[model samples]
Target chain A: MTKKERPDNRKLDEIRPMKMKAGVIKRADGSAQVEFGLTKVVAAVYGPRQIHPRHQEDATKSVLRCRYNMLPFSVSDRKRQGYDRRSTELAKVITEALEPALFLEEFPKTAIDVDMEIVQADAGTRAAAINAASLAIADAGIPMRDLVTSVAAGRANKELLLDMTKEEEDAEDAVDVPMAMMPRTGKITLLQMDGIVTPQDTEKIICLAEVGCKKIYEAQKKALLEKYGS
Target chain B: MDKEKTIESKTLSAEPAKIVVPGDILKESMDILPGTGTFRENKNIISKVLGIARTDGRVISVTPLSGVYIPQRRDYIIGEISGINFSNWSVDISGPYEANLPISEVNGYIERDADLSRYYAVGDIIFAKVNDISKTKYITLSMKDPKARKLTGGFITELTPSKVPRLIGKAGSMITLIKERTNSFISVGQNGRVWIKGEDDNVALQAIEMIEKYSHTQGLTDKISDMLDKALGKPKEKE
Candidate 1:
C-alpha cells in the first residue's frame, strides 16, 4: 500500500493539469466545468432568485445551498446516484467554503443554489467541486467579495504531496488534507484531515495547499474574465 | 505555474472602461468614490461584481452583464398579470420577487367584489413603473403614470437587463435609431422585456440580437448601424 513516488511523475509540489471554463450550461443561471486531470466536475448556480417555501427565506441576506453529487458512472464501482452520508457532508462543507466569498446580502430573501456534479472521480473531488462552484457563481453574475479556490495536500510514504490522486489516497499512512480558501485574504474556509501527519508537516501541507489554491484561483479568474470577453 | 503577479497599485485613474471580476481593486485612491457594484475597503475601491467598470467623474461603478433584475424605484418595467387579489394584483416582473400592483394604482375605479378580470385579466402585459421596493425585497409597481398602460398587440422578447442602458444608448439614441429604421413602436423595460409593435419587427429583433451579442465590444453603435442599413435594403454606409 506504500508508494515511493508519484504515479504521474509529478513534483512533490505540483498539482495536476487543470482546465476551467465558465458559462458551460445554458439553462442554469450560471455554470462552469472544471477538470483536474481526469477528475471533472460541472457546477451550476441557479439563484439569487426566488426561494420557495417563503419561510425559508433569509431576512438579511441570500441563502446559499450546495449539492454535491457523483453520478452513478462517475466511479469504477458506480456511485449510488443518491444523497448518502458522504455526499451530504461534502455538500455542506463545500457550501461553507463558498459562502464567505459571496456578498449574499445583495439579494435579500432569495436563495443561491450551487450544484456540483462530479462526472469523473480521481480523488480530491471536494476541492475540484469548490473550484468549479466558485467559477459558476461568478459566471452567474452574483456579486461577491472574492472567489474561493481549493486543493488538497497530503502525505504518503513520508513525502508531502500536492493534489493527490486515488493512487496516493489509497497508500498506507496517507494523509489527505483538503483545504479551501479565499486566496486574496488567505482565509481558510475549509480544512479537513483524514490520516496522521506531524504538526510541522501539517503546516507545510497547508502552505502547499495555498500555492495550489492560488493557481486555481488565477485560472478561475481568467475563466470569468474570458466569459465577459475581457 | 506562472509567478504570482501583484497588481501595481499606482496605475493611473480613469484610464478606460475595463472588465473586472469580484475582489478586483478598481481604484486605490481616497478621492475616488465607490459607486454601485463596487465597495471601498481600506482606501481601495474594489469591485463587487464581475462586469465592466465605468467611471463617472470621481465615482466608479460596475455594470453587471448578467443576473436577475433587481427592482428599483422609478425603474420602468414590464410585467404580466399573474394573479388577482381583492386589493391588488400580483404581477410577475421577471425578477426574483413578484411585484404588487395595487388596485388603486390601476386606471379607473370599480365596485368592490366586481369582476377584476373584466378590466385587467390574467396574462395581460402591463408596462409600469416600480413605485417602491421594500426593505424585504418586496416589489411594488405603479401604473398611475401616463406612460404606464396595458400594452396590446405587440411581440415581447427578453434582453439582458443590464444592457438596457446600452440598448437605449446615450440619451435614447440607439433605440431611436432602431425605431426609425424599422418603423416600429419599441418599448424597452428595465427588466429586460422588449415589446415590438409594428408590421415587421424581424429586422428590429435581429438588431437587438446583434447588440446583445456584441455588447461588450467597442464601436458597437457603428456595428449596429451597419447591420440596420443592410437589413433595410440600403447600401452599407461608408465609414
Candidate 2:
C-alpha cells in the first residue's frame, strides 16, 4: 500500500523546533512551559510534604502523584475536564516515568504532586507532558536523581520519525513508541511501544527517542538556567 | 566565587573546544562531565548520551547528560484548588494528579465546632505545608505549621502556573527584587495567589501589575529588577 507522504522532507530522526520556559508559574514551587513545535504543555510541581487521609504514607519514600490533562480547547476537538480514561492512563505512565528519577526516599511520609496541562495539542502530548513535568520539578526545587526526558518515536510508512505530530500519528499504518529516560543515567523510566515492529526496528526507535530526548534535555537546561542561573 | 570565575573564563575562552566524550571531566575541582551527543542507526533506534557521574568515589551526584525534570523538597510552590472533598482540598500541583489539603491542615486555628467553610471557602487562596502522603494517594496538609497559612494583605497577580519559577528566580532573586522595589512584604502561594503588603497599597499593586504584565517574557528578572531599583531610587549594580 502506498503511504501518505509527510510535510517537510526531512530525515527520519529529525525533531521539530523545541522551546522551553522554566518558572513560568509565579506561584508554583516549580513550573515550566514547553512547546514541541505547536504542541504546548504547562507543568507544575508541589510537595515532598504530608500525604492526606493519613493513610497513603510510606515510611521509606514519598509517593509520586501525577495528573496529565488536556484543556478543553487544547485540541482541534474540545476535550472535557476531569478524569478521562486516556488521561488516567497517561497520568499513571507519567508517574511511573518520574518515580525512578525522583529521590522519593528523601521525603518519607510525603507526596510530590506533578500536574501537567496541555495548552495546545498538535501531537506527542504525552511526551510533551513528560518533558514539561521534569522542568517543573526542577523549577520547584524538588530533589531528583535526574531529569526524565521523553520523546515519541513512531513508524510512519516505513520511516521512523523522532517526534510525531498529530497528523503523522493519525496516519494509517503508524506505530507509536513513547519512551521516557533519565537523561543523566541513560536508563529507561517508561517505555511504551504500540503497533508492530521487529526487534531491529524497536532498537532503532529507541535510539531515535534517545536523540530526541537529548535535544529536549538541552532546551530544558537552557530554560532552567534562564530561571535559575548556573 | 571561584566556580563562577571559572565558568566565566570558559565562556570567554578563545578556542572552541572539540566535542568532549561522556565521563570526560571538564574541570579538575568541580569534576563536571561534558554533555553527550546523539546517534542513530537503521532509521530506528536513535540514542544520545546524557551525562556521567562518579558513583563509587566520594563525589556522589547525578547530573543530566540530557534534559529532564528534577523535583526537590522544600521548594515553594503556587497551586490552585482543583477539586474539594469533605475533609480535604485537591490542588493541581502541576503533573498528572491533584495534591490534597485537609481540613485539619487549614492554616489558621478553627474552633472544634466552627465551620471550615467560613475560613477556607473553595477557591480561597491559602498556603500550607505538604505534610505527608499515604500509599492510597492521600495527601496531608498543615496550615497550623508556622510556614503555612492564608496569604493576606497583598495584591495578588495571576500567571500561568508554569511561570511561577521564573517569577521567583534562582535563590529567591526575582522575589527579592519585587520585595525591595515595592518595600512590601510579599508572600507567593503555590496556588497562583500572591500576597503583597506594602506601606502604600498603590506601590504593592503596581509591583504586582508589573509582574503580571511581563511574567512570560524574556529577561523579566533583569527588567523587573531594574524597574524595582529605579522605583526605589537604588543604584543598579554593575554585573
Candidate 3:
C-alpha cells in the first residue's frame, strides 16, 4: 500500500513554517527577509531613483526591473556563479507579477529595482523570492494597489499538496504548479506549471495554492505593520 | 508627528487613525473620496502605501511613512549644484528628478559664453523655488523670488522628506522654538535639507535629529521643546 503520510507529516493543505520580517537591510530603501521551512531568502528594493542607460527610460512612467539570484552554496550542488537561463527567466516572470500591483506612472523617467537573493533553497525558492520582493517594495514606500502573495502546490503519489518539499517533488509522478495572486482581489498574477496533470488536478491545485497564498498575505501585512512598532 | 493632515475636512468617526499597508481597505462607502496615497475601487477606498491611514470626514487619505522627495510647484527648498551646462545648472534637491536652473531664472543678465560656473559653481547651495515640474520629469527652479538667495557658510543636514512637515510644526511653532533657543538662523527646506547658520548649531542639529527619530510619537513638540531648553541651559518653567 502506498504511504498516506506527507513527507514532513504536515497536513496536505498546509505549507511550511513561514517567517517574514521587513526592513532588514540598513542601506536599502526597503528590504525584507522571509523563511519557508529551511529555505531563506532576502530581497532589497532601491530607487524610483534615476534610471541608467538613457535609452531604457520611458517618458510616461517609471521602469520596473528585477533580478533574481541564488547563492552558489544555496543548493547541495553549488549553483553556477552567474545569471544562467533559469534565473533570467524567473526574473522576467517575477517582474511581470509585481508590475501590475504598482502605480509606476507616478514616477516618470525613473526606475524601481528589486534585487532578490536566495541564501538557502528547499523546494519553493521562486515563490519565496516573490513574497520577499513584494514586502521589500512596500517597505521602500513605493505606492502599489496591493501586495502579491505566492506559493507552490503540486500533486505527488496521486495526492494533491499545498506546498511540496524537495523530497516530495522528487516523487516519480509529481507535478508542480507555482502561483501568485493579489490576495485582496483574488486576482492571479502568476501561474506556471511543470510536469503534466489532469485539468481537474490543475483546478484543484490552483485552489490549494490560493489557500496557501491567503495565509502568506496576512504574514506580509503583519511584517510591514510590525515595522511601525506594534 | 502622525504623518497626517486635516485640512478643511472634519474628523472621521468610524475608524480611528492606524497604521496600514498597501491594499488595506480604509473605508467602504460610495460617498467617501480617496485622496493622496489612497484610491477608490468598487465603492471601497484602499490604501496605496505603508502609512498611517486617516479620514477627514468624507475623504480618506494616507500619509506615507517614507518615500523619495517628489518636487512640487512653488515649494521653496535648498538645493546643491551637481552639474553645470552652458545654458543651465542641474540642482539636486534630493529627489528622483533634477531641477534645471536657467541663467534667466536668476536676477541678472549674463553673456551666453561667459563661463556659467562663475555664477553658480558645482557644490554651491541655494534656496530656490520649484517653478515647474513637467509630466516627463523635467523640473525648473527659479531663484528670482526675493526670499530666494545663495546660502553660504551654513552646513547642510538631511532629514527624511516625509518628516519635514513635523520639523516645521504647526505654522512654524516647532522650528521657531528651536531657532530662538539655539540662536541659529535655521532654514528648513520642504525637500528635507536644513541649513543652520549660527555660532552654535549643535543644539539645533540635535533637536532636528530627535524630530526625525521620534516623529511618529504623540506630544513630540512639547518633548522637543523641553529637550531644547535643557540643551540651551534655560531654566525650566513650571506652571
Best of the candidates, lDDT: 3
User: Tens-digit lDDT track for model 3 on A106-156?
Assistant: 998999999999999999999999999999999988999999999999998
What are the DockQ scores of the candidates, in order?
0.79, 0.06, 0.83
Predicted structure with the largest DockQ when compared to the true one: 3
- Scoring only chain A, what TM-score does candidate 1 earn? 0.96
What's the true lDDT of residue A50 in model 2?
58
What is each predicted model's overall lDDT from 0 to 1? 0.86, 0.64, 0.88
Candidate 1 Cα deviation (angstroms), residue A219: 0.9
Candidate 1 clashes: the total is 0
Docking class of 2: incorrect
RMSD of each: 5.8, 10.8, 3.0
DockQ, computed on Cα atoms, for candidate 1: 0.79
- Looking at model 1 chain B, report the run of 10 residues with the lowest lDDT sum: B1-10
CA error at residue B123 for candidate 1, angstroms: 0.8
The TM-scores, one per candidate, come to 0.94, 0.55, 0.93
Look at candidate 1 and give me any clashing residue pairs.
Answer: none
Q: Quick one: ranking by TM-score, best first?
A: 1, 3, 2
* Native-to-model Cα distance after best TM-score fit, residue B125 in candidate 3, in Å: 1.3
Greater TM-score among 1 and 2 belongs to 1
Please report how far candidate 2 places residue A184 from its true position, in Å: 1.9
